[model samples]
Every structure is written in C-alpha cells, then in structure tokens.
Target: MEPKNQTSVSEFLLLGLTDDPAQQPLVFSLFLTMYLVTVLGNLFIVLAVSSDSHLHTPMYFFLCNLSLNDICLSTCTVPKMLVNIQTQDQSITYTGCISQVFSVLVFAYLENYLLAVMGYDRYVAICHPLKYTVIMKPHFCILLALVSLLLSTVVALMHSLMLLRLSFCTHLEIPHFFCELAQVLELACSDTLLDNVLVYVAMFILGGVPLSGIIFSYVHIVFSVLRMTSSKGIYKAFSTCGSHLSVVSLFYGTGMGVYISSAVTDSPRTTAVASVMYSVVPPMLNPFIYSLRNRDMKGAVRRLITAITSFL
Candidate 1:
C-alpha cells in the first residue's frame, strides 16, 4: 500500500439535512430559532443558579454544569450548520471537522456522566437524607465535576487522535450536517477495525457504566419512595426526581433512537435526523423540564428575573 499523506483531504462536504433549495429557507429559519432558544434557555438555568444563593446546593451545581454542557453541545454543531445554510455551502475544513468531533464528544460524554451524577445526588438526598450533606459536600461535588470533565476529555481526545491516523479519499463527503464520528469512520480508506473495536469498548465502558449507575440510583430511589409511610413524603420525593428522570429519558431515548435508526436503515440522512433528537432536542428542552418541574429552580428564576427587571 502506498503511503498517503494526512493532508490528502483538506475539506469535507457536508450533505446537510436536505438538498431542496426551496426548503432551505424554512430549514434555516427553523434551526436558527432552535439554536437561539437552546442557548438562551440553558443560559437562564446557569444564571438562575448562580444568582440565587438559595440554589447553591449540589443539585443546582450539577444542573448548572448540565446547562453549560448543553450550550456547548449545541454550539459545537448548530452555528456551523446555520452558516452552511445561509451561505449555501457545505464544505467544512478538515481542522474544523476535527474540532467539531472533539468538542461534541467531550460535551456529550460529560452530559452522560453528569446525568448519572445527578441521579446519585437524588439517591443520596432521598435514600440517605441525613447523610446527604456529608456525602455531597461542596468539595466532593467539585471533585465529581472535575472527574467527569477529565474522563470525557480523555475519551474525546482518544477518538480524535484515532481519526487523525486514518486517511481519506479525494471525494470526502459526509452525509450528516456535522462530522459525526461514525460517519467519518465510514468514509475512511484505511483499516477501521481498530476504530470499530475502540468505539465498542468505549460504548461499553463509557456508555454502559454510567447508564448502569443511573438505573441503579433510580431503582434505589424508587424503593425508598415506596417504603415511605407518608403520602406527602412520597410526593415530595417523586417530585424532585421527575425532572431528572424526564431529562434522562429524553437523552437516552433519543440516543437509542439514533443508534437503532442507524443500524436499521442504510440512510445516513435518516440517522442524521435521529441524531438531532439526541444532540439538539434534549439540550433545548432540558431547561424547560428542569425549571418547570423543579420548584426551587422556578423560584430562583423568578427571583433572577425580578432582580434584573429592578436593575433595568
């Protein structure tokens, strides 16, 4: 085999969501709105948590991080997509594509681990109420956050490095709006057996482990709630969990849909659309789900709005 230079492909053509010129305007408008809303909504969560000292608990700390992750996740993809739509250009530079893949992977995995951490927070609060403060202390919470960020960064770095080793052909076109890891791997000319193996190992360790933690945490929570003698206690416990559970369901459900769609259909477009649900929709809706279902969050947001209004 001839030694191909890494610079063989300087750019990749992104096919985007749809090729219809007529629908371009509508698609652009729709995504622009979603992008703005996602940013603003998650921003509010972060601000509300920061402004309100009453919300300075471990739970809200995690929520703030989750919101930040959502903003980053959306930023990693949407701005580029919006730009492509407006300019009627789908080409992404090789460097830009690599950056996108790295950024998205970091945030995506961070969110995954964060969700599990939040579930653990809930479990400690509900199941071990007396020890909640002791177990989820400020320093401890910070440690958890740091660990999540570090692990995610390491894994994302691994994937990006692996992709860098592979070579691409001249006609480098990606069917998705962004440079999804799977799609990029599929386009590679070099042997992808190692990449596939690494991806599966990552799926099992990174994906399976955190998901198991969330499930275990929730199961303990449910049992604790069921054992409660007081109806009010049960209601309060369930209420606290409702938002997190909803966010969890949305994240994993959409993620599973993307995987299933990709496996079931050979259509990259369909998989791309499904990927939107996990990558785009969940982040956009997380703020709403958390704030609406969480009394402390709503109160904090109201206080935040009132303070801003008074200042203005």
Candidate 2:
C-alpha cells in the first residue's frame, strides 16, 4: 500500500475522551457548561478592562489580550469536540484539522508570551515604580502585543507547513479531542525526524524563554517586596502580584502536568484527558482568579456592571 500525501487524505477520525455511548451525554453537558463559562468569563474580563478607564494600564492591557487568547484557545478545541459528540461524527476534514493545529499553536503561544509580558509589567510597576510609565509606555505595550502575535503566527506557520510535507498512513484515527500537532505527526508514514526535532526546538525557544522571563521577573519582584520597610508597602506589592502568580501557577502547572503525563503514560486517551487541565480548566478559572483576587479588577468589574445595569 502506497502512503498518501496529506492532501489526498481527506479526513481523520478523532477518538474523543471516551467511546462509551452512555457517557456521551454526560461528556457533552460537562464540556458545554465549561465552554460557556470559559467564553463568558473571559468575555467579561475583556469588557471590564475596555470599558473602565481606570484599568487602562499595562497590566490590564496585557490581561485583556490574555483573555482574548484564552477564548481563542478554547474555541479552537472545545466547540469542535462538542459538535463531534452531539452529531456522533468524529471525522475532521484534513483542512479543518490542520487549521485547528495552527490556531491552537498561535493562541497557546500568545498566552505564553502575554503571561511573561504581564509578569514584566508587574515587575516594572513594583520594582521600578517611578520608571513604570516611562518604561512601559502605551506604544511599547502595543508593540509587545504585536510582536507576540507575529512570533506566534510565524511559529505556527512553520509547524503547519512542515505538516503539509508529510505523508500519512491509512490509520488516521487520533485518540484526542482536537488535532494536536504531536499526535498528527505520529500518524505520518514518512520520516518525522525533522518535524520532531523542530517541535522540541520551538518548544524550548518559545516555551522555555517565556517561562524564564516570568521567573526572572517574579524573582526580582520578590526581592523588591522583601526590601520594603513598611508592612503596608509589602502588602500592596504582594496584593498586586497575587492574582498573576496564581494564574501563572495554574497555567504552567497544568501545562507541565499534561506534558509529564503524556511522556509517562503510553495511553493516548490518558494524555487526552490530561490535556483538558491545561486546555480547558485554566481558561475557565483565570477570570475568576483575577477578579476575585485583585481589588482593582473587582472595582473595575463592579463599575462595569453598574454602568451596564443603569444603561439597561
């Protein structure tokens, strides 16, 4: 049997979280609820930041982008899964799968860069308070966001183009909800040595560098906080960073868990289930983490709600 080029392969079967007929309804309801929460929660964050003049700063600006990215990330995977479950059709067209891979990568990488940028914003505001406005100007903030988006697009394009080169075997069933790049590569019949190498290289450069930046920023922040003589100053510093740190922990912790679980376990299904932690849970929880923990965000949201209600 001749290996077919990716173009010739019309579709791939996605073996979602479970195959149980009885469990489909439960899965559908669970993900539908989660998807709604994730979208609405992130949407509220964006609205709160944009509508409130008080939150028109670097931190909230980065946070607004992060919320948008989270919405995109979840949209890339969950709706398709929901549709698949509801229709009892696991088949995804080749173009659809590739688009999913690219979209997921773009948004996921954007989130990584945005989080690191947010950490740097906090660090500047805390450790170099007088220089915060000068260093993180409005133009610079916009530039940072554009750069993150450009880098994410280029990286995702590279991976997607590489995927286009590979030939796939007949057995094209992916044991996951969405079209994950790694899993798609595994299905390729052609040599994926170069593809695999590129994946790790991109991961290290994209993933490691942002993580390192976040750690470095927070380390400086911690030192600055410790140096504060006033308890009030110390409390203020911690309060400012608490929500971001919690969000970072949730994002990175779940991401690392997915990677570790995938590496340790041989079951693709297990990996799929683990992926929900990073791909679904964090997005749903992030808005709550920020709004509940940060006083400024709470105030902004409250004002936003009041305005909306009064207008209504």
Candidate 3:
C-alpha cells in the first residue's frame, strides 16, 4: 500500500477564503477589484518610469523592476482565485498548482532582493553622495537586476523540483485560495523531512539575508543623516527615504505578522487571511506609497496621464 505519486492526483480543491454560499459573489467581486487595482497601479508605475527621462537613474531603474515583479506576483495567485470563484469551481490541476507555487516563489524572492538592492542604493546616495553616480552606473544596475532574477529563478526551481519527489494522499483539498507550498506539503503522505529542511534553508538564505542587508544599509544611512548639521539637510535626507521606508515597512511588517500568526494558530483559514495581508495588500499599496510620497514620481505620472489623454 504505497502512496500515489503527484501526477496521479489530477487536481486539488481550493477551499478559498470562505465556504459560505451566500458570500461567493461578494468574495468574487472583492478579489476581482483588488486584482484589477494591483495590475493597473503597478502598470502605471512601470509606464511612468519608462516614459520619463528624468527617471533614468539607478533608483528608478530598480523601482521599475519592482513594479514589474509586483504585477507578476499578484498575477500568479489572484487570477486563478478569481476564476475559481466566478466559475464556482475550486479545482486546480496538478500542473497548474505546481506552476503557481514556482511562480509565486520566484516573484516573491525577486521582490525581496529588489528591496534590498534599493536599500543599498539609498545608503550609497545618503552615505557617499559624491560617488553615487560612479558607484551605481547603468550597467551595474542592470547587473544587479539580472543577478537577482537569476538567483530567484534558481531557488524557486529547486523548491518546485524537490516537491516532485513527494507522494500525496487522496485528501487533496487545500484550505487556501491558491496552492501555497506549505499547504501543499502538508497534504503529502510521504515523509517531508527533506522538503521541510530545504524550506528552512531557503528561508534563511533568501529571506534572512535580504532582510539583514536592508537593516545594514539603513544603519549607515541613519548615521550619515545624523552627521548633517543643517535642519534642511536632515529634512531632505528623510524625504528621499520616506517612500522607500514606508514600502519596506508594509512589505516586511505584513510578512512577519503572517509568519507569526501562522505559527501561533493551527487554523488554516486564519493563516490564509493573514497571507492576504502580505501578498495582496502590499502590492496594491506600493504604487500609492511611491506616487503620493515622491514628488518626481507624482509629476511623471501626471505627465503620463496628460499625454495619454491628449492622444485620445
């Protein structure tokens, strides 16, 4: 009596956020609105960055990539959930679930790395303003982005490939809206010691390293700003870092909250709700944080809107 291979399990049922029949339409509408807002908001950020010549700096370069990553990350899970809700069908094929898992990991890690890279960019700007241009050349910025993408892809592929080794049981209902890697792993009938070990290792390398880098960058930035004697210089320094700090706080704060909540609670539904705070809310809020807090970004977005309307 051996467990079935992953291929043999044709599909898994996603229980989504709620099971109440009366709430289906409301759920569908809410997620659809969020998904649309996420896509359009991030898309506008990308377009503004690319269209404005004033935004051709290393910081904007990284911001553009981040906007793209956020769009991909939201697309990875939300659309499938929306489809399931609209169709009243919660089944996701084996291939689709695995693909979702891989895609989610890739974009999530990319976002993490980009945030760290942006932090370093800020540190260099604030700590060594004279060498900012030389330190962050266009080619160097491109290299950092490519390296982040490569590492994110490699790490995600490793996890997804390792998941292929596990054998699953007949009970294939996932209590989450999407095929979260941890939820999927919990359903496996085979011993998941190796899988769990790899997960922990990846968490440390991918998650902890970037977080540490961000903290390190900010430490120097804070010290550099403190050395400035003029009140205007202090205000200018904080203003430059304000949008980035707000975004970083939203991303990591929600993520850490989700992690802690999941660890404390055994309820899958509770965990799923917490996951939305990190996954859905941050992406939706990032564009607003940047555009509203950043004068340059606001001007660029306004110009972009004007150009589009004039052409129409």
Q: Residue 295: error of model 2 in Å?
A: 0.4
State the RMSD for candidate 2. Answer: 1.4
State each model's CA lDDT, in order: 0.93, 0.94, 0.92
Please, what are the lDDT tens digits per residue for candidate 3 over residues 19-40?
Answer: 9989988988998899899899
- What is the TM-score of candidate 3? 0.97
Write one digit per residue (lDDT tens) for candidate 2, span 8-29: 7899999999989899999999
Clashing pairs in 1: none
lDDT of 2 at 193: 95
- Estimate the Cα RMSD of every predicted model relative to the unseen true structure: 2.0, 1.4, 1.6
Q: Could you give candidate 1's per-residue lDDT for residues 176-242 as a string of tens digits?
A: 9899999999888789898889899998999889999999999999999989999999989988999
Cα RMSD for predicted model 1: 2.0
The per-residue C-alpha lDDT of model 3 at residue 176 equals: 97
Assess every candidate by TM-score. 0.97, 0.97, 0.97
